[model samples]
Target: MTQFNEDWKSDRIGSALRGENPLVITEMSSGFAVMGDTQFLPGYCVFLPKKTVESLEALPMPERTAYLSDASLVGEAVLRATGAKRINYSIYGNTDAFLHTHIFPRYHSEPPERISRPVWDYPAEHWKSNDDSYKEEQHGLLRDKIATALTQLMEEAYLEKDV
Candidate 1:
């Protein structure tokens, strides 16, 4: 079992910035797109701002807009990569006090009761148990899929803007 530094839980963005976190899928203009540690729901990801900010509103307007756009791009990628029925976008800084977004891919394969509930409603062990975490191989494939999807979407958006 790989042991993570205790600081990682308190400074996820910092860990990613320092190259200590292996979850990073790709870096965006405003933030980094990282795969969630757990794989209970495949393609789960988080968007973390490159600069530390207590809340979303703390960012400059342009930065905030860029972060939001990045979150949407991540959601689109997760949707495509996972074949999810829909993606859930959430921003709650109560815990970490950092400006970040969680992008969850909701699937048709989920139980009927869970399909309509928030991802948080799932078993706590799903997030808390290290045993449930994704292996490096799995993480790499998922990261590639999401990164590829995001790249395609970005290119399409740029082409549209140019036209």
Candidate 2:
């Protein structure tokens, strides 16, 4: 149902592709990697497919492979940039109704009990926009670090595979 309109007004993927999304770090082979709105977990990000597809099954085998591979690249870059203990990857079309992947960085410093829980369970404060929200002025450096790491990883990966 989601479509990429030219104005990039309602579509994040469209905004990202047009170089209008300030949160976009860089464009990967399969899609665009944009910074997340919340920094509750630093280095959180999302990987969006290049095209407007409702689900993973909508993509052909090659595109699907590229999307998955690029998702992993984003996770690794986040890990390298934020020193996260591990990464969490999730893709569900329920909320957004589009093809995208969420890359969450799990830190060792997280509350012990909540560390193992899904990010959605981290309380409302983490998800709501407030004083501690993503501002380019504050989080730009971290975004750049992740972008640099991701670019390097992509180069090495695609080069090795000759893709």
Candidate 3:
């Protein structure tokens, strides 16, 4: 099993960002999928690659298949966990050098007060802080739930030789 590192340069960083949960949420096979730290957007997720491969074609056929499967699993987990109305997936590696997919869960009346603004544009204070141990623990719990769901998905997929 590949361990997720805290260094953002590494693809495993997404796992650490997911509060150390590799089960419900994790890096895709190429090693880039992850859950963001902010609950303000709730169910926000990302898929990142392990190596610095920019284009999707850079990945081998099997890896590409697994990557898509992993992305879908994470998106499904977020939808189930948050009961989100819709899931939005984006891959704009402009701000960050690492190529990653951003999965945003759109809700009925979410984003609190700054509903009109982009999630990144909102003030940092609008989001919950990861400073407190209790907050971290809570995030860990939610991450675990998602990880569990992802694991089940993997099992089902493999049972059908879909993995």
Candidate 4:
């Protein structure tokens, strides 16, 4: 048996804060937009708070709002980049004990039963299975697509603000 560096999963927020994680797509108003390690869903991502708060309620009201807004922006980016039929937003911190929002891109091409169910219901193999892991080239392409979408959206928001 091999022991992998699960450290990335353990302290994703810390890694992002340190600028040590290549998975970070961009720094948003309230958090960092990071690509998911597993590419099963293609454009999956997470919005991680800059500070390590246990939950959204732990943040100031304004910060909480910003985090939510950032999560929404991530979902929009995933949708635009992947052409996903829908996006799933979730924020359960049972395992990681950190404040983060999962932005999952749901596709119409997904198996019918899996499409309508919670993403957690998908087989474990799809979650982090070595066989289904992302190749280097796939990671670059997906990251670029999401980053481009996020940049465009941010530009649009700025223009609107200036209008």
Highest-scoring model, lDDT: 2
Whichever of 3 and 4 has more TM-score, that candidate is 4
lDDT of 2 by residue, 45-145 (tens): 98999998999999999999999999999999999999999999999989899998999999999999999899989889888866557677788899989
The runs of at least 3 residues in candidate 1 whose Cα sits more than 4 Å from the true structure, single-residue gaps closed, are 1-6, 159-163
lDDT of each: 0.86, 0.88, 0.63, 0.85
Candidate order by decreasing lDDT: 2, 1, 4, 3
lDDT of 3 by residue, 1-163 (tens): 3464445334444444454544225544446446675666666777666656565667788887777677777788778877777777776667666556677777878655645445666566645565422234456666666677777776787678753
lDDT (Cα, 0-100) at 32 in candidate 1: 88
Please report how far candidate 4 places residue 30 from its true position, in Å. 0.9
Candidate 2 Cα errors over 4 Å, as ranges: 1-9
- The lDDT of model 4 is 0.85
Look at candidate 3 and tell me the lDDT of residue 160.
Answer: 85
Q: Model 3, residue 150: displacement in angstroms?
A: 0.8
Error of 3 at 18 (Å): 15
Candidate 2 collision pairs? none
**Could you give candidate 4's per-residue lDDT for residues 16-126 as a string of tens digits?**
887766678999878899988788889888899999999999999989987887788889999998999999999999987888888899998999999989999999888
Per-residue lDDT for 145 in model 4? 86
Report the C-alpha lDDT of model 1 over 53-153, residue by residue, as the tens digit. 99999999998888898789889999998899999999998887778899999999999999999999999999988776867765767778899999898
Position 58, candidate 3: lDDT: 72
